[model samples]
Target chain A: MNIPMPDFMPALPEMFLLGMTCVILLLDLFLTERSRVVTYLLAQSTLLGALLLTIMLYDNSRTLTFSDTFVLDPMGSVLKGAIYIATFFVFLYSKGYLRARNMFKGEFYILGLFGVLGMNVLVSAHSLITVYLGLELLSLSMYAMVALQRDSVVASEAAMKYFVLGAMASAMLLYGMSMLYGMTGSLDLTHINQVTAAVGSGQQVVLAFALVFIIVGVAFKLGAVPFHMWLPDVYHGAPTAVTLYLSTAPKLAAFAMMMRLLVDGLGGLHAEWQGILVLLAVASLALGNLVAIAQSNIKRMLAYSAISHIGFLLLGVLSGTAAGYAASMFYAITYVVMTLGGFGMVVLMSRAGFEADRIEDFKGLNERSPWFAFMMLILMFSMTGVPPLLGFWAKLAVIEALLGAGGLTWLAVVAVIFSVVGAFYYLRVVKTMYFDKADAGAAAIESTLELRVMLSANGLAVLALGIYPGTLMALCATALSH
Target chain B: MSFEQILFYVFSAITVLAAGMVITVRNPVHAAMFLVLTFFSSAALWMLLEAEFLAIVLVLVYVGAVMVLFLFVVMMLDLNTTLLREGFARYLPLGILVAVLIAVIMGLAVGQNHFGLAQVAAPAPHAASYSNTQQLGELLYTTYVYPFEIAAVILLVAIVAAIALTLRRRPNTKHQRVDQQVATRREDRVRLVSMTAEERK
Candidate 1:
């Protein structure tokens, strides 16, 4: 067979970031401790440059490149933009935390930039091979980031656990992809969709098996129940700065992976996969919310909360409609914002020698700094899906999607109940901030003006978006339409 | 049975036996040797199927390079064989049950339905001059070039991750600082004066 040359235009942003990351990696080696800020600046500029390129190459229509392995689409563009903005905030918040812990090094920024590049590729992947490569790249970076603090035994243990579990999940995904390839005789997702759609009963068994494996892999990444064993430990053990990075941007890439695999490639097998997703979603909601209530550590609590939020995300995907997909996209973006704010507070409250991981750290936060406490309140309230916050709209959109799906109304009710149960912990945080008295010797929050400003903007954005989520929702809908 | 069919059975038997020994062996070094044997037998099996490139790669990359690394690691690690084997008997029942279950499932899935020779005929033998490696390389660099590049990137990430995770800077270790060295001045280090000499007496 004659081979066709691959086009690289659609991958311009990825190419740009890849080149920049290498330069930054080498540039960071020569940087002194005081000059590490240069690395941070370069990393940020890399992200900005990528964002600009993505915008310049933006089109509402989908375009396939690199032999149809990579794709450029409106959904990817929107998600890439969201990931960049989230990473920008994460970097800004992490700088002080890193410096305080003597973990201020070029490695964090370089690895982080690499992770962002991975996310960008994941967002644009159109084939199984691309998806696996991007996911591995991201996983490796995350495992390194989690263990960046070499002196911390806990961090090392956490990194080992994350690495092992993540490798297994990647294997499961590859196994599933291999099975799908066997059944369809093609690795291209579109071709697989066509083959799956045309398969007879005999092939359906293999397809079902593949779907089970793929969903297991996806659930592991989402930290859904049963596969969520590693999430809380990694979250609690890593430095607060890494936890902040972990919680915010990676979810967007994971969401993109789900969309590409489930909605784009395996849409033909929806009837089968949706059943599996429904079970996972309900289990995640029940387990995530219930377990989170028992956690006294804020990081662990948010880890469980991330699990439950993933349930909500799956609820949107299981709706099996364009509108449902759009709603999930919207929820994913909003959840990232909420994550930045929630973990930003953890980073803010932490000092050089003190870790603000305990639930009690937020006691009388209002008494300390009313402005930030209110921001914290907004984040917690939004997470609990309280009214007039962006989190509310996010949940409402998913619930609306489920209701629109007709038969899934009962699942919606179960989700709402779990969210209500989930609300208790978040409100307890709010109560601690507002009602409890601050300890006389509690360390004061040492924060930069940039963090305070960005965090406030992040917090208020939730409230602002909640009150009026029209534009963003419309954008999500538009991205999903084509 | 034909001579070729008898040879096939021999290679298959060796591959299976060696693979079984890989997991069941007590000594880590023995396990590594068993794995190498398994890889060689599998390469022979692949050669029987006319997949010359894959057979050579299995021997060259896996048995030659990867197995050597495994053997080195096994030697370097101070592992207690008795301690490692302590819990094996206790877990044997559960392991056997799962293994049997998997065997039965495979029997039904691949054995009964998919593996019928009538369903999948053996390929005709290639001409003696046919170079599987050339065709494989052409496909890898041309048609599958996207995946090829991606695989390269994954390896790059692996290198970065391995180094970043394992490399540590010990705070107590003495290392020259270029900036400190460059900024050093004679006055800051020496501090000599006539009054100081009188005070010393």
Candidate 2:
């Protein structure tokens, strides 16, 4: 058989990332521990370069590459740009935390770069094998990152659970793919669509089973209800910086993937998957909100809160239209900003040798640091979907899409109720800061001026996006239009 | 029988036997090793089926990289073999039940011929120029692109999750912040002084 030569020009982002990772690795090896700043700078610069390249190469019309396994278009560009920007912030936010933990090695930056590359590949993937390759690359890198803190028992246990569960999810996805392949005699989405369209209603049941199996993988990635058992423990166990990273960029990528797979690939059978997504959405909303209220740990609470947000995001997908896809994309972008800001606040409050993870840790914070308290207030409000903030706009877009789709009023009511319930925990953080007494023995909350400035900008962006969400919404809509 | 048929049976036997040993091996390391053998033999079977690309990749990735990592971890860990054996008796009934159920399911699936195995014609000696991998590649690159991408995104999420889990804060360590390190200049952290004997006092 003749070997297919891949065209390299369309793979610019991945190639850039691969090159950058190697350069960062080399720099880390030559530089002293104190001089590891170069690695961080390199990572940020590389991400910015890739983001720029993605924008420059943005094509509204779909252009398949590598024999049709990858497609470059508006959707790919938007997702890639968002992921790159998120990774940039993730690097910035992680610098202080990694240094504090003495895990600020070169491998961190390399792995992160590779992970970004994987995400880029995933967002553009046009075939099953390419998808698996991209996914495995990302997964292997992540497993290494999770076990970076080799000495922690909790970290190890979290890693183990994540690995086992992740493997199971992957297996389910693979099995689903196999079934689809067997049924359609092709792995291409277009071919499958043709085959599925031709098949009678009787074959829909098999398709439904395959779709459900595939959705299981997506739900697990989103940390929605029933598949959410991993989130709280993983979040609470991981470093605050890592948690910040986890809660942001990857969610956007996952949403992009779900849209590409379910909405585009299996769109002909939306009736079946829509019901499943609705169930997942309602359960995620109810369980995520109800369970979060009792959590004392800030990270764990946010994890649950994230699960609930996944429910809202799923609402957008359930709409099963271009508008729904746009809303989901919009929700993902808003979530990234809010989550990063929230986790950034947690990082700022933390001092060396002391983790500011518990809800009580923020008590009396207003009295000591009014500025930080206000920032925290804005972040919490945004996360709680309070009006005039980014989170509220995200929720509105999703609900609007769901309503437009029609006949999901009960699901909408569940979402609204859970949003209200979710408000309690967000407000609880605010109350602790404003009304509760400060702990005398707590470590001083001193941070570098750079961190303070970045954190403020990050937090304020949420408010800015909330007030003028038109630009972001327009971008999301345009991205999904193709 | 033809040589090709004989070879197919040989690889098939090896694969099945290795797979069975993967479950029955008492030592966890041995079990893992058996799994590797099973993967290799199955890859050979794939080769026989004219899926050379997948067969080679299966060997390179699973047998080479994944299994090596598995073996490294299994060997490094101080596993209590005695403790493992102790649980076997207690879980024997449940394990047997599960094994039997799996066997029944497998039997039914193969017996029902739902996999279309019976419809697959015996491969001709000079098959089409387009190999299994080539067709797979064409199909994936062209049609199945969306699912492929979705899979990639799922993997990205998993990666982030793993990193987030393993990155824990330790209370006692002192490390330098990247921002602080970058902010410093030669003049700030280093001093060059020329001292005269009289001024030195």
Candidate 3:
């Protein structure tokens, strides 16, 4: 006659973050500009505190609560922990940059914190409705964040583009989800998977149509080629602080969404959606690598690079194997680290008048400061998939997963070639930093000791992980194995 | 046709006609009014489907509330819609192409090829005693509670974001502050000058 209540323990971290975000929002309203640093502290502590809560609540088994729409699993917890770390760096690096440009406001931090909460929800989503809800929550916050710099025409345009396209994507996803519901008679992924797996070819045509729409929606969110039109413009148009927030953390959420929808929900249609991912992966690799070379703006270049990394990320997913998913997860973590460091450097170089977003801005970084130059070198090299960096192992893991999948070897070759071409652009960055002469009036490197130390450590993590990538990969493997 | 079928066709046809008029009408206010009619007809069609909760909510929310607010906006904006639609002709072919594509795809999606009784068997219809509202409420409060709360957060974000973007403290603007007005006293806003009458000379 009555159902048991859902467990509150699995969702403790999300609950904690949401409460703190509201508290910080109110706290910021009353504080003067001089004490506004408290907001930053509170937001950072919220992330740290959530991370702690997640660690405390971590269990090896999948824990479903809240009507089984939300599932806290090994993957969700690990990915959420990754999101927290990435967002931590985003806020830390954005502090000086936003303050210098007079764009520092409580709204940015509040929205960013909300974005993190959205990503957290996204990572744990277990049902069609939860997935869409999380995606919309994440998307809306990003739209607001992009348009936060309201005075900038470019930013406003970017926000408009992102909003329109994101809404269209959400519609496609909802359409697909409703179709699934109609066909399978359930919105829960576990039930959908069982029904779909048993239905076989009974309704393959409609199922394939639904699959296409879902793939399109997922690809759009992941910024794969063909649906990646808004990524670069949004990245380049947004304030650097916003770009810093946009480029990190959310990738984990998007990745989790992919796994939940494609791998878990529609695993029965692996034959259909696998091919779609292959096409997206190849196109993204070719187009992203080739196009990034022509980009003079560093933000646009990184956006394209994000696309290429997504290509690699898809390689792991499309393999439809535990090893491949783990590889993808490993790749996502490494990419986030490299992107954070890369964008952190961009933010560090920027000051009041100059936006260090142009490729030329990195010229003679060695002359400016050899230590940070070395740091940038490490990040660029890692991005190039050079050996002895975390990125190299990530690429190898995916390529190996492709080989493990037997017929995906050619796709792996395509990925390898694209990586080689990708190296040209990433290495060009390093070359410019080391080879080119500093501008005559180039100012000396200036930043807080804290940013310098954290950034250097960020760079070193890539190298350190490259030397030993087992622990993270094992974590990813275990998360997906169950 | 039976009377119910006849009424269903009438409402659906009106819904389609009004929807088309929403886009083609020259006047923006006319378009808004057309949109309202479209909502009304759609609601009527839903009423025929035995989904009273949805039908009532559609009429109450979309037709009664949203459309009225939309009409007010249209009447207030005084838009130069003729100038705005100048490019409508240029984009008509592309727009038609997309619309046709979507129509065909949607037709296939819900069409007989995939969704008919012959292709996929339909579930048994609900009994007269079944309450769609009760079922929906059970799901919303139990299994879908997470999404319900997330939706609340999203609306909160929307409210915060809209205010953040549009609200500004310009100090230069001439808007009155109610708090300042309420705080004013005899000694504050009115300095009791002893020789105020002499100033007129």
Every model: iRMSD: 2.1, 7.7, 1.4
**Ranking of all candidate structures by their TM-score, best first:** 3, 1, 2
Q: How well is each residue in A1-482 modelled by candidate 2, as lDDT tens digits?
A: 44466666777877777777767766776998788888888888999999888888887888886667777878878888999988888888777878888878777777778778777777887666665566666666666666667787887777678778888888878877877786677766666777776766655556766777789988887888899998888888877776776778778777867876786577788888888988898899999899999999999999999999999999999988889889999999888888888888888888677789999999999888898899899999998889999999989988888788888777777788889999999999999999999888866687767788888898888888899999999999998897
Candidate 3, A1-482: lDDT as tens digits: 49678889999999999999999989999999888899999999999999999999888999888877889899999999999999999999889888887778899989998999999888998899889988988999999999988888999999999999999999999999988988898989999999888875757767888889999999999999899999999999998889988888998899999999998899998989999999999999999999999999999999999999999999999999889999999899888999999899998998887889998888998988999999999999999999999899999999999999889889989999999999999999999999999888888878778889899999999999999998988998898888
Estimated TM-score for each candidate: 0.92, 0.83, 0.95
Worst 10 residues of 2 chain A by lDDT: A1-10
Q: What share of the true interface contacts does candidate 2 keep?
A: 0.02
Better of 1 and 2 by lDDT: 1
For candidate 2, what TM-score does chain B get against the true chain B?
0.75
What lDDT score goes with residue A206 in model 2? 61
Among all windows of ten consecutive residues in candidate 3 chain A, which has the lowest summed lDDT? A197-206
Give me the displacement of residue A191 in model 2, in angstroms.
2.6
Q: Candidate 2, residue B165: CA error in Å?
A: 14
Best candidate (score: DockQ): 3
Error of 2 at B168 (Å): 18
Worst 10 residues of 2 chain B by lDDT: B108-117
Cα-lDDT of candidate 1: 0.89
True contacts kept of 3: 0.76
What DockQ does each candidate score versus the true complex, computed on alpha carbons? Answer: 0.41, 0.07, 0.68
